[model samples]
Target: MSLIHVNDDNFASMVQKGGVTMAEFGAPWCPPCKVLLPILEELSAELGDSVPILTVDVDESPVSAGRFGVMAMPTVIVFHDGEPVEKLVGLRSKAAYAAVLAKAAALSPESPAAAR
Candidate 1:
């Protein structure tokens, strides 16, 4: 699956949807964010349709960034049922992201992963 691009217009609705939503908040120029992209992509692939992974450019979507209190680039947030359950900053390993996804899935009542 591909990463969904989120903006101020759709950010609220995207994360507010039931189940697990992973939102990566960063800018194009951020080096750490750039490094994190492929890792998240890999994690998304591993998770398949169990979780939705989203990317939001802080430069283009300041409203959503500010709302989430994103003080730095490469902020990854795992939202469960519209509430943020995990927040990570900087570049992290794919394993770390997988752990977060696992937590999100376990917490989401709508996730089929929870049945596994």
Candidate 2:
């Protein structure tokens, strides 16, 4: 799993990097965030080198989370080439989130990944 931990400092690059990215906006104390952790891990592992999955601790870097307009814990946002294209709040199944990723991947300009 390619999980990059982001704080106030590294959020810009994390969001603006190439390819599709699924970034989880969460707080350490949020139970739903804890629940979604494993699903993100499995997603990162399964997606291999194609898409990147990252975690943002809102408690530490509220700026990034706020910039993305993440108003709640366990919010998932998909960014493609630095622009957000989709968002989901609360806990969601892997398949549901995967569909979001698939759509983001397909929508990215010049991205070669096939939409599933």
Candidate 3:
């Protein structure tokens, strides 16, 4: 799956749907944010429907960004069961993000492994 672009209007609904959701709060002009975009896309493809990857432009969706207290560009928040579980600020390695998503998926009751 590709990264979903969320604005203030649909951010809550999109995130709270269920399972593990990774939302990147960033801006188009930010260097680090640009750098992280491809990484997120790669993860989105790798994880497929198992994890939902979202992107929010801070400049366009200030409400959502401020609600999450995202003070830095490229703040990636991992949410499980509609609640914030892990927050990573700044640019990070793909493995770091993958690890967090794997942990979140394992913790989610909706996940198959969690059911088992």
Off by over 4 Å in 3: 109-116
Please give the CA lDDT of all the candidate structures.
Answer: 0.86, 0.84, 0.88
Candidate 2 Cα errors over 4 Å, as ranges: 109-112
Q: What is the TM-score of each candidate against the true structure?
A: 0.91, 0.90, 0.92
The worst-scoring run of ten residues by lDDT in candidate 3 lies at 107-116
- Candidate 3 accuracy as TM-score: 0.92
**Residue ranges of candidate 1 with Cα displaced over 4 Å:** none
How well is each residue in 30-96 modelled by candidate 2, as lDDT tens digits?
Answer: 9999999989998888887678788999989878888889898899999888888899999999999
- Residue pairs with backbone atoms closer than 3 Å in model 3 (clashes): none
